[model samples]
Target: MELIEKHEEILERRAELLEQMESRREQLKIQRTKQVEKSEAARHRNITLLQDLQKIEDRLRGRQLPRPHLLALETRYWASVEQSVPAWEHFLLGKGPHPTDGPGQPPRRTKQTPSTAKGSGLPPRPKPRTAR
Candidate 1:
């Protein structure tokens, strides 16, 4: 009888220990899941920050120098303007041959006296009546 009671007690203790171990395992699993979720969140944040940094770097590089195509366009525009400046000056100042005139002909001058200025489409204003 004594031996049977001792054996039964031992079996019960073993069962209790097993139950505690199972509960501990469940707790450990929950903790591990939480840790994994935190790590994944941190990883996503890091990736986003890296992408933002890359965008900023790209913008900085763009600001440092204009694109080659835009630079070329600007250079071409200035060259065109410089080339035409002499012709424009000659035409405006009437100091040399005009671009539209024959090679050796001088620029033509137009008279611009106010009395002869009737090019405006609007009818001339009536002269203000004197305050009699």
Candidate 2:
């Protein structure tokens, strides 16, 4: 009779442990679902904000305004170019290379013909013998 009671106690403990494990598993599932929903909401909010910013930028571009200082600066730049036009033409027509092609680039090397051929007069190298 005592043995039967001990076995029943162990079986009851096992059933309680299984029930607790199942409950914990369900709670974890619920937490994961909540996290996913929050992430999706954040993504949607970011997209909406970016769209609103783009709209504001488009409106600003459509109604462009000219400032007086910028116009003055442009006029001065063009006037200086016009004043120096004759000097620029003289430099371009000069015999030296253009200033734009500065000495920064390396000079190209030319390929030489084989020295042993025909009128080169150099001795030819011997060919290596192959083993059988």
- TM per candidate comes to 0.49, 0.44
The candidate maximizing lDDT is 1
Steric clash pairs (candidate 1): none
Off by over 4 Å in 2: 1-3, 66-132
lDDT of 1 by residue, 1-132 (tens): 999999999999999999999999999999999999999999999999999999999998878577899999999999999999988896667466656777577656556556545664446758899998
- The alpha-carbon lDDT assigned to residue 2 of candidate 2 equals 100
Model 1 bad stretches (over 4 Å): 64-132
Compared with the true structure, all predictions reach lDDT values of 0.85, 0.79
* lDDT of model number 2: 0.79
Who wins the TM-score comparison? 1
